[model samples]
Target: MSSVTSSSVSLPQGFIPVMLTPFLESGEVDYDGLKALTDLYLEAGAAGLFANCLSSEMYELSAEERLKVTKTVVAHTAGRVPVVATGTFGGPVVEQAQFVKRIYDTGVQAVIVITGLLAEEDDSDEIFIRRTKELISLTEDIPLGFYECPVPYKRLISSEVLAELLPSNRIIYHKDTCLDIEEVVRRIQVAEGYRFGLYDAYMVNAVASLNAGAAGLSCIQGNIYPELIVWICENYNNVERQEEVKLLQKFFVDSMDIVHSAYPIIAKYCLQKRGFPISTYTRREVGELTGNLQERADQLLEDVDRIQTELGIASVFRKTLEVPLK
Candidate 1:
């Protein structure tokens, strides 16, 4: 493993948006569109950017494309916020470690290893521990994080595994999708005394998770209205905003299907409507968006506009590209 100072990098907190990989209408990776998207996230107050995640269509992207995209995002962000990119994708440990090294060389703060990639279905925690330990041993000095990726299968990490890993401080960030507030609290408690962060992907429990000491949010909602997520993070504890927070959380829960049912497709469409120069093309095999879905997405955007206006936060949506197309 390459040697680097992992301890010097603080794990990011706040709305670290799981970014979507923008594509041109012809289905090529839209490098220019991606630069705009990066700027859009930063302008909307994202504390960090999560590239090559599930939302970024990692399974569909070639390894070379993944590295290229990660490098583009890191160069554009220019150290304004930390970047975490997925480094493993269910392959041999050696191959996974080599990819980690390559991704770390992109100047990302940390490499996220999907927990599902460590072992097969029905594998015991002992196997998981053994494999993860070996991988860690091989990739020493490179900061690592865990993501409970839902694709292939969503393998929620057991407390035993967390207990074993957190103390070592090698795993500094966890993108948790367990969706249970109590479980999230338990995970946070397990990492208590360690320099780790748990970013909840379940938008419904974002505020509660933050209240329970979760590090921040890693959700698709951030792609559409990151400022709203940032607002909840900023004021989740304010006595005056209690009712307002509840209402916002309710909106997230109710609009889950409208905003995320189709995922990067709907997210890309939402971005296009917002004036981002990207197509709604997704690498997923999912077919084109139906008229009904398009109508629902439009309504969702309108609803979000109204909510932002009512909250006096419409100014956050202002889009000005800091990185011009080359």
Candidate 2:
């Protein structure tokens, strides 16, 4: 490992927004659409922005496209808040290292390293861990966060090994998304102190994670509804927000149940419907949002409006947040 030291942690503690990539008609990237989405999230009270990850459909874009997207987002964000880009998978250690180095020069606040590209059953922890260590060494200058996702592409970092890697401040923030609640609780028991901050990646498990000592969330829903996310993080510990949190949780379940079925496809489609500009229908292979998926999205859109009114958030903005579905 290189003896490079990490810089002081400056990333916002909670409510990091995972941005959705807006595409063009011919499947080209919509840089203008990206700027509009960035402005929307910033205005919606996002503490930070996460780009080119799952939410941004990083895997679908070409290397050059990824760089351009990251550069455009950083420029659009205009330093209003922190921007964390994903530099986890690009094949071989050298390529991953080069990818990390390229974005590091773009001035992102940090990078979130995915364990491996393969689903959990396909890859061993040894390969993932070794790559993580290598990537960490290469990215010694810019701080990195470990993304702990679930099975079928899972890279759930064990608390024990995570502790071992903890000494290197290169790994500062972690997005806790292990589907196993018991595992998350157990890990939280091990991770303590202000130096290591954890953010919830799942909406349903977020409350428990918050109670279990997660600093806050880096939410996918924040891509569509940011004010609600801001309220939860700021009021996560407050007794008054408990009821509101429950309502938000219900909204999350209702929304995610629909959106996640098609994933980035449905996500981008919803954003486009809401008058939030997007260049394309969806990312590659993920396909366009339609059929039963379209119906489900419509139902959820209506529900979100009702829930927003119930939570007294509709009046928060002049133009109501719309996810107009057909």
Candidate 3:
């Protein structure tokens, strides 16, 4: 509510990366690196940014760090595009609502609710709906979204549950991790007239989801080769590019395991190799990048270049990153 606003018509489409938090070796948030990373995403053609997310290791960050991370992105963006952040950690509905308001005040267009953080795995949908309702009431009209974050536990909300919530006109975005195309379709079908969208995070069916009307993708793969993701989003349905699209889709399906191995570290490592000046440190305890994984990542980097060449697209980093560290 800082006078910053989203379309109210619909959320931004295409790549909305779940941002990674660059950290110093001493574990301090690297604001400078964060700024550079943000610019890289924009240069790569990201339609929006999802900061302070699970990819950003929201659980590991203190509330103060979360605010600062989000504020830095918002300030750096200076209204270039819509930005969203996870607003809920584990807490009561009221406390969660309070933090949502605080995050929205940081100038993000939407405050994302981590689904697992809202209810226990065994909790009834009725209980979950009630708490969500209470949160909506307490938070007023600030735009809200849902992330089926896997940390606490991924709570893939039912189409029934989503139907119940959309009438409020409060929920404007969804980061879907259901990994089910039919479920994604149901959510999009039900959101017909609302100012809301579902950005699919499961890349295995990225093109299928796009064809099914997903706003776009918000996935970890974007952390590694964001330009590739942007390329897919912009050309998912290009009939003439069907062959290239299928190949890219298969590449995503095959590379999923490796890309997820060392995670933000491997992602950062890959970025460093791409000539970006960002550290490979992570606060998530996702294990170190060992020799075997290192080789895989190195080979994967080569495959990325091949994909770029075959697709006739260039990595925006190559053009935007002016110098490489010796």
Candidate 4:
């Protein structure tokens, strides 16, 4: 196998925040906010950062905006840590590959792809088989991570089909948001020797996934409580570690209560509360999150601060999740 193929599936320990795109009153990308947020996460010990993604509202941004975000993030990060950007917009395969090429040229370390983006909702195994091959062909040589997000709007690739498509070492890892833990384990086990990994996006399943052989995690909860993630990764199965992980998990669930299911809205709100220059405003065309979600989100942050202080850890601590920050 090639070095990229044989390389360990494990990423550096801790949270890999899927960054939020701070916006202005006119709904333009807030460059200053983006820079400040990046600095804050790096200081708070995020394992890595992913830009132009679901959290960053890549689906709403134009291709030009996507490229701009990638450029700004890479430039600000310098060489401090690994950075990945979303590829495969809700567009044609070839057009998506063009977007991939554009960002790869910007020097991002990896590309995270959504398998298919079609008007009709269906995913034949052949789509992944052929599309991944085409992506590999077009990118020349950029590492790829499949974002196995739930596609309620479209067809989903089965775990069996995903396992079968692992021959392409370009698909090195997966950010699995599938709520089915058993299914994820079965799929990764099937692809054992192919250098694939699973990053648990659901905070509740994170410890279980790690115990089940996930190489790392890319959690949203990490945006607020990264130290717990780092501690779990560094000391899995230790007795003290169990207490810490349990506390962290409870903290995460409690935090979720404030937002309920308005995840993006709540996440951005918390980021702003942490002194990151993010606006609570989202594109109105995308629709608003119902309920007084932001109020609950604020309460969650207040609770987190109370917990962090009770534990005597700094409200936020720093660790290097990537190397050679520029």
Query: What's the TM-score of every candidate structure?
Result: 0.95, 0.87, 0.96, 0.84
- What's the lDDT for candidate 2? 0.71
| Poorly placed runs, candidate 2 (over 4 Å) | 1-5, 117-127, 149-152, 314-326
Q: Which regions of candidate 4 deviate over 4 angstroms? A: 1-10, 118-120, 150-156, 224-232, 284-291, 317-326
lDDT of 1 by residue, 1-326 (tens): 22456666557678888999988767889998899789988888888999999999999999999999999999999989999999998788988998998999998989999999999879988888888888888887788989999888888886668998775568888999998898888989988888788999999898999999998999989887787898888888999989889989999998887776677788877776765666777889755677899999889888888888878785444446322222
Report the C-alpha lDDT of model 2 over 1-326, residue by residue, as the tens digit. 21223656656667887788887677778788788778888777788888877778787888888788888988888889878787756467777777787876676777777764522456766766666677777765767877754422666788876766766667767887776677777666666653566777888876777777777788777765677778777776788778888877767766766656667677665555556656446665765566888787767667667777777774233345553332
How many residue pairs in model 4 have overlapping backbones? 7
Question: Candidate 1: what lDDT?
Answer: 0.85
Comparing 3 with 4 on TM-score, the higher-scoring candidate is: 3
What value of lDDT does candidate 3 attain over all alpha carbons? 0.89
Please provide, for model 4 over 1-326, each residue's C-alpha lDDT reduced to its tens digit, 9 standing for 90 to 100.
11332244434645677777878867788887788778877876777788877767777888899989988998899979767888777666678788777877666777788754533455556766776677678766667777755442534456777766677666666777776789878867877876566777876677777888877777766655555566555555667557766776677665655543566666666665665545677652334655566666666777767766655557453233322211
Give the C-alpha miss distance for residue 219 in model 1, angstroms.
Answer: 0.1
After superposition, the stretches of candidate 1 with alpha carbons farther than 4 Å from their true spots are 1-4, 316-326
- Give the better candidate number (1 or 3) by lDDT: 3
Could you tell me how far off, in angstroms, the CA of residue 85 lies in candidate 3 after the best superposition?
Answer: 0.7
The per-residue C-alpha lDDT of model 3 at residue 102 equals 92
* lDDT string, candidate 3, 1-326, tens digits: 66634335356889999999988877888888899889999999999999999889888899999999999999999989889998988788989999999999898988999888888999999989998999889987888999998888889988899999998888888999999999899999998988888999999989999999999999999988998999999999999999999999999999999998978899988888888877787888888899999999999989999999988887776636545432
Name model 3 segments beyond 4 Å from true: 4-9, 319-326
> What shift in Å separates residue 161 of candidate 4 from its native position after superposition?
2.1
